[model samples]
Target: MLLEATDIHKTFQEGRETVHVLNGVTLSLARGEIVSLEGPSGSGKTTLLSIVGCILTPTSGRVVIEQHGVNAQHQGELARVRRQYIGFVFQQFNLFPALTALENIEYALNIKGVKGAAAQREAQRVLVAVGLAERLHFLPRDLSGGQKQRVAVARALAGNSPLILADEPTANLDSVTGGQVLEMFRALAKQENRGLLIVTHDPKVRAVADRVLKIEDGRLI
Candidate 1:
């Protein structure tokens, strides 16, 4: 399994009350598989994605990636796991406005400790993979919504992470562009053998996934 999350639960203390987000949610993703997580608003979709992406520590339960059990309490270890095993894509492109498409990917690789000429090569390779080769030097401002999202995808793929976690990746694009992006995701999982867990509310996205899982009231159903 590329990713396995078992009995995941998250609770937040809000003043005097406790807000229970995820309750014993269990799921797994295998290599070359695309899983879509669907849920309503405030149904803990993003919260679960955050925990799986290693940005937030779960209140309980375990997350294992590539056979290594993650130590959520160890910040350093969490960072290492995130850098070495997981890539994240968000609803917003989240590209630096001043950076070109290639530069944006290069920056992501730099965070993974890849820099200089090696970073440049990997950045170019992934941009081409996402069909953004012609827009390599275009700044975010110069690119369309789909192009910017493609750059974000390339950034996520730059380090060759085994698992990709995407939260509402197509939320900001039109139907045509969203379909194109979904196809690219399918190619990445099917051809590149990357595991993808996409959190989305769109039925079209669920239709494209190899398996569609729904969450309600913090539990997977």
Candidate 2:
């Protein structure tokens, strides 16, 4: 297994009231496989993905990335492990307006302190893999919805992270375009041999996953 979360629990307090979110959730993923988390609105699917991505720490649970053997690491160390091994994509394009598509990918490498001409070269290679090489110079405002999504995917791939977490990645695209994006994700999972977990309500995506998990009322059913 690449990821393992055992008996995860989380809660949030808003003012004097405590809101329950995830309750004893456990999940795992293996290499070179695609998993889809399916849920309706108000389900805890997003919350679960957030925890898995290390975007939100669990109130109580164990999260272990088996490859890095990080179960015993501290909070800061766990975060660094996540940064070096995980890539995240969201429903929104989340592209920087001022930066071109190629530049945006390079910025991700820059965050990891990878610099110079080599970073740009690798960024271009990733963009080409995602079928966005011709539009490398375009800004987010000038690209179509599918093209923008490809750019977002390129950014995620630039790091060469072993795990990719996508939250409603194709929610904004038309059915035809969404299918293309789904195909791209499948290719990434197979060609890159990475673990790809997507949290979405889209039926089209569910069809593409190796396994589909249903979530309801904060529980995986």
Q: Clashes in candidate 2: how many?
A: 0
TM-score of 2: 0.94
Model 1 TM-score relative to the real fold: 0.98
Give the best candidate by TM-score. 1
- Pairs in steric clash, model 2: none
Cα lDDT listed for each candidate: 0.92, 0.85
List model 1 lDDT by residue over 54-96, tens digit each.
9999999999999999999999999999889888888998999
> Which ten residues in a row are the worst by lDDT in model 1?
184-193
Q: Candidate 2 lDDT, tens digit per residue, 1-221?
A: 88888888888898999878888888899988899999999888998998888877788887777555554337777668766888888799898999999998898888766788988998899899989879999989999999888888877777778888899999999999999999998897779988899999899997889999998878889
TM-score of each: 0.98, 0.94
Q: Please estimate how well model 1 matches the true structure, expressed as its whole-model Cα lDDT.
A: 0.92
